[model samples]
Target: MLETILKSAFEWRNQLGLLNESEALRIFYGPGESNHPELQHLSADLYKDHLWLTAWKKISSKVLDEACEIMTRILPFKIEAIVLMDRSVVASEAEVVTLRGTSRSGRFAVKEFGVKYLVQMEKTKHPGLFLDHSPLRFWLQQTQKNKTVLNLFSYTGSLSVAAAHGGARKVTTLDLSKHTIEWAKENWANSGFSPEAGDFIYGDTFEWLPKFKKRGEQFDTILCDPPSFSRSKNGVF
Candidate 1:
């Protein structure tokens, strides 16, 4: 069952050249594998030099071993590592576990539509870049020209970077985490954007939305991608 499932996954991967090479890809999504019910708990993403697994539910070590062995044997290119993210636990306690090999210095520099983002594998809740949003980023890069953009709950400013790269007149990034604001600045700088290229807001989304509304601040585009709870200083949103 494992071998068949993985083989089909590779076949799907081989056919994904239809997507632009510059965009990052979620090569194998497990829940989308509806035929094999148990395999739905797992998904795989291919990065520049590694394969990343995300598990929503726990499985036996034997099943995990089989999956890793098959991936290592079947993949054509040499991989730096095969990492697993066990998301069965709450985000606060989630772990990025390396099941096969080690990532170089725990950082893998990846690109989407020619935009650079440094992804971390070990000891990080998320690797900074979210591969699933690849197409949306590409859309922003193509469509945001000469527009003013606002990114709410922006993490690491991947979207803002895309919008700015598309020649948006101004890109404003708002986030609750100061770390993410700094991280976004680093990414923007890495992509050849000046520090003054964007306005970074470090505050709660609930508080800021009303303020923006009251102030009559208008933007050509406003993006909001919040976490599950959306709990903030004001309350749940």
Candidate 2:
């Protein structure tokens, strides 16, 4: 099983030109339609200095050993850590299983499309950025000039950062987590945008959206990516 995974990873590296750069990337993806029939339960993501492995089912020690060996052989740079996670759809929290190396405390930056985002690998289910949304970021960067943008359920505000970078006149980011709001500000600063350029609101989207509407606030563009389920003091979404 490990040999098959390594073979596919090496093939993907060559096909994707992954080894030519030291950037965040999805080295492998499984557990979905992209998965190979035999390796349908595994996935991997490279986050700057870390290698994040994920599984939809139980993974054995032997597979972990082989994965580490293969990663060492394929990577051009030394990884600071190799962390495994459980990404089952029904799982409520991301479970970390440190297969090798160690991660530093607090947040670190990962670059994509020349924009830097602050990520906390051990802290949240998504760590701070969502790599799959790169195309949306690109589109926002190209088209958002002078627009008033609103991002709801704005996790760490990556989309808001994208909008601001594209010269949006006003960008508003709203989320329930105060910690993530602060983290989003760090990402905004890292991307060379003024903190004052963005309005960071920490509040429940269900509660805030109506308030914004009542206040006659309107946006040229709005991003609404809510979680599948959520619970707040006001109600569940």
* Top candidate by TM-score: 1
Cα lDDT tens digits for candidate 1, 90-173: 877887888888775555567776777767667777778888778788899899999999999899898999899999998999
- Candidate number with greatest lDDT: 1
Among all windows of 10 consecutive residues in model 2, the one with the lowest summed lDDT is 30-39
Local distance difference test scores for all models: 0.80, 0.79
lDDT of 2 by residue, 80-155 (tens): 8888777654666656767788876678887777777777767556666777787798789899999999999998
What is the alpha-carbon lDDT for the whole of candidate 1? 0.80
> What does candidate 2 score on TM?
0.87
TM-score of each: 0.90, 0.87
Give model 2 RMSD, 1 decimal: 2.6
Model 2 stretches astray by more than 4 angstroms: 4-22, 32-38, 88-94
